[model samples]
Target: MEAVDVIEVSREAIWVALKVGGPALVIALVIGLVISLFQALTQMQEMTLSFVPKILALFLALMGLAPFMLTVLSEFTVTLMDRIVALG
Candidate 1:
C-alpha cells in the first residue's frame, strides 16, 4: 500500500482502539477519582482499596460495552479483509 493508504489504515486502527477502550477508560478514571476523594476524606490510604473498585468498574464497563465493541471490531475486520481481497 502507498503511504496514504498506510496512514488511513493506521488512523482507522487508532479510532477503533479508542472506541473500544474509551468507555472502560472513562469508567476507571471516574471510579479512581471518586475513590481518591473518599480516601482523602476518610484518611484511609489503602492502595488496594482503589485497585479493586477500579478493576471491578473497568470489568463491568467492559462487559456492558462488549457488544458494541465487538460490532466495531468486526466491522473493522471485515473492512480490512475486503481491502485485502480487492488488492489481491
Candidate 2:
C-alpha cells in the first residue's frame, strides 16, 4: 500500500479505537472523580470503596454500550475490508 493509504488506515484505526473505548473511559473517570469527592468530604479512606464502585460503573457502562460498540467495530471492519479489496 502507498504511504497515504497507510496513513489513512492508521488514522481510521485510531479513530475507531477511541470511538469504541472513549465512552467507558469517560464513565470510569466521572465515577472515580465523584467517588474521590465523596471520600474527601467524608474522610473515608477505604481503598475498596473507590475500587468497587468504579468497576461496577465501568462494567455497567460497557454492558450498556456493547451493542453500539459492536456496530461501530463491525462497520469499521467492513470498511477496512472494502479498502483492502480495492487495493488488491
Candidate 3:
C-alpha cells in the first residue's frame, strides 16, 4: 500500500480503538475521581478501596456498551477489508 493509504489505515485503526475503549475508560475515570474525592473528605486512605468500585463500574459500562462497540468494530473491519480489496 501507498504511504497515504498506510497512514489512513493507521489513523482509522487508532480511532476505532479509542472509540471502542472510550466508554469503559471514561467510566473508570469518573469512578476513580469520585472515589478519590470521597477518600479525601473522609480521610480513609485504604488503597484497595478504590479498585472494586472502579472495576465494577467499568465492567458494567463495558457490558452496556458492548453492542455499540461491536458495531463500530465491525464497521471498521468492513471498511478495512474493502480498502484491502481495493488495493489488491
RMSD for each model, in Å, please? 0.8, 0.6, 0.9
| RMSD score of candidate 3 (Å) | 0.9
Q: How do the residues 1-88 of candidate 3 rate in per-residue lDDT, one tens digit apiece? A: 9999999999999999999988788889899999999999999999889999998898888889999999999999999999989987
Candidate 1 lDDT by residue in tens digits, 6-84: 8999999999999998888888889999999999999999999999999988888888899999999999999999988
lDDT computed for candidate 1: 0.93
Lowest summed lDDT over 10 consecutive residues: which window, candidate 3?
21-30
Please list the residue runs of candidate 3 whose C-alpha ends up more than 4 Å from where it truly belongs after superposition.
none
Superposition error at 7 for model 2 (Å): 0.4
Which candidate should be chosen as best, given TM-score against the real structure? 2
Q: What are the lDDT scores of the predictions, listed in order?
A: 0.93, 0.95, 0.92
Candidate 2 stretches greater than 4 Å from native: none
Runs of candidate 1 with Cα error greater than 4 angstroms are: none
Q: Check candidate 1 and list the clashing pairs.
A: none
TM-score of each: 0.94, 0.97, 0.94
